[model samples]
Target: MPSLTHMALVELEKAGILKFVISQNVNGLHLRSIYQGRLAELHGHSFMETCPSCGIEYFCDFEVETIGLKETSRRCSDEKCGARLRDTVFDWEDALPPKEMDPAEKHCKQADIVLCLGTRFQA
Candidate 1:
């Protein structure tokens, strides 16, 4: 599912050169990529929603409309607990999602090499 460049990264990981990927992109491209399992979405995903009551992630094919961690129009599929599903897309006002942040922080500390895509990320 990865593009040529992303597949190149997958190759690195396959070779044990790339340990982890920390991404702030909401495009959901990474999720569709072959390296999806090895990456994290730091800013939440435009096509994902999470159940607050039960920690389950729903990855949808369609792009979620709302930002700022607002509740989406859908409900959790779990019948016993039909909780409102919150869109994972985050805004500047919200804090970084912990599910993504914790691993990113851990990898940043452990990795000997860090690649900055563009903007400088201050720890």
Candidate 2:
């Protein structure tokens, strides 16, 4: 269900025009579009969960039932560390995660052109 804009981004990445993507979208559409290059999901992806202990991420096929970094019904898959898995999405008051933000900042500093779509700058 990738949109034409998403497909175009993928092609741009393939053609080496687009380097990295910094997305505020929680729907996980960029990954679905097959853009396998660098990405930083600032708000968090609804289909993703992460282990608080091991920092391993699990990308689910369906939307997670919880947000606000709440614990899901599953545990981490790593045999040595089966910590509780928490949804990646954030609530209104939650601060943006540094794991996603740091790389995004780094990319933004390095990029010559930053193309933003469907979002507004809040100052």
| lDDT per residue as tens, model 1, 1-123 | 456866776678778898888888787776665356568788888988989888689988888878888888999989888999998888987888787888888888998998786457776
Q: Distance from true position, residue 93, model 1, in Å? A: 1.6
**Residue 54 deviation, candidate 2, in Å?**
2.1
Model 1 lDDT, full chain set: 0.81
lDDT of each: 0.81, 0.89
Model 2, 12-102: lDDT tens digits are 9889898888888899998887554488888899999999999999999999999999999999999999999999998989999897889
True-structure RMSD, every candidate: 2.3, 1.7
In model 1, which runs have C-alpha deviations exceeding 4 angstroms? 34-37, 118-123
User: TM-score for model 1?
Assistant: 0.85
Report, for all candidates in order, the number of backbone clashes.
0, 0
RMSD of 1: 2.3
Q: How accurate is candidate 2 locally (lDDT)?
A: 0.89
